[model samples]
Target: VALALCVIFNNSPVGSAISLIGMMLCLAGIFVLQQAHFIAILQVLIYAGAIMVLFMFVIMLLNLKQGENEGWASREKNLLLSVLTGFLAIGILYKISQVLFSVNMDTPASLPDSFGTVAVIGETLFTDFVLPFEVA
Candidate 1:
C-alpha cells in the first residue's frame, strides 16, 4: 500500500523525485536490516545522496512535466501473462526457500565488530571475487 502511494506520487515531477529518494533510502534500510551495513552505507552515499541529487537537479533543470499514464486497463492476454508470471515467481521462491531452510544450520553466538564493516567487505570482495568485481 505504501509502495502504491509512492508510485502515485511519482506521477508528479517533484513528487517523483522525492519518491525516488525515498525508495533509495528504503532500500538502504533494507540492506542494513539484512546485516549488510557496508552495502547500506554505500547505497545511501552513492545512490541516494549522489546519484539521486544529480537526477533531481537534471529533472528540475529540464522542468519536466508529468506525462499521461498509459495502459490502465489490462487486456485478457496481458492478465493471463501476469497470472502466469506470478505463479512462476511463487514457485521459484518456494523452491528456493525449501532449499535454504531444509538444513538446520548452526547459529553463530556472536559476530566480530568488523563483520559487515566497509573495510572487511572491501577486503573480502577484492580477495574472493576480484575478477567478478572488476568485470562488473
Candidate 2:
C-alpha cells in the first residue's frame, strides 16, 4: 500500500526508483518471515542496495522529466484496478495460508530447526550449485 503511494505520487525517475527499492525491501521482509533468511538478505543487498543505487544513478544522469497530464488519465479506472488487484492478492494469500495450515492437520509439531547460517548456504551454493551460481 505504501509502495503504491510512493510510485503514484512520485513523478520523477528518482522517486520511481526509490519506490521500487522500497518494494524490494518489502518483498525481502516477506522472504525473511517465510524462513528464507539467505534469500531475504540477498534480495536486500542485490536489489534494494546495489541495483537501486545503479537505477538512481542512471535516472540522475538521464535527467528525465515527468510527462504532463495526458488525456484519459481516469482516476476511476485506476481505483477500480487497484481494488481488483487488492482482492486478488488477498484471495491468493488466503488460499496459500489454507494449504499451509492444512498440511499439519494430522500431527501439529514445530518445524525442525533448519541450518540457515551463511557458511551452510555458501557450502551448498559453491558445492552443489556451483555452475548455476557462476552463470548467474
Candidate of highest lDDT? 2
Extract clashing residue pairs from model 1: none
Residue 52 lDDT (model 1): 83
Cα lDDT tens digits, model 2, 1-136, are: 5586657656567877888888999999999887779999999999899988998888899888778866336686568667877997899999999998878678755655766767788999999999999999
> Per-residue lDDT tens digits of candidate 1, residues 56-127?
898899998756666354465456656766887799999999977886668645777788887888898999
User: What lDDT is reached at residue 17 by model 1?
Assistant: 69
Q: What is the lDDT of residue 35 in candidate 1?
A: 91
TM-score per prediction, in order, is: 0.60, 0.71
Error of 1 at 42 (Å): 1.1
Off by over 4 Å in 1: 67-109
Candidate 2 lDDT trough over 10 residues, lowest sum: 69-78
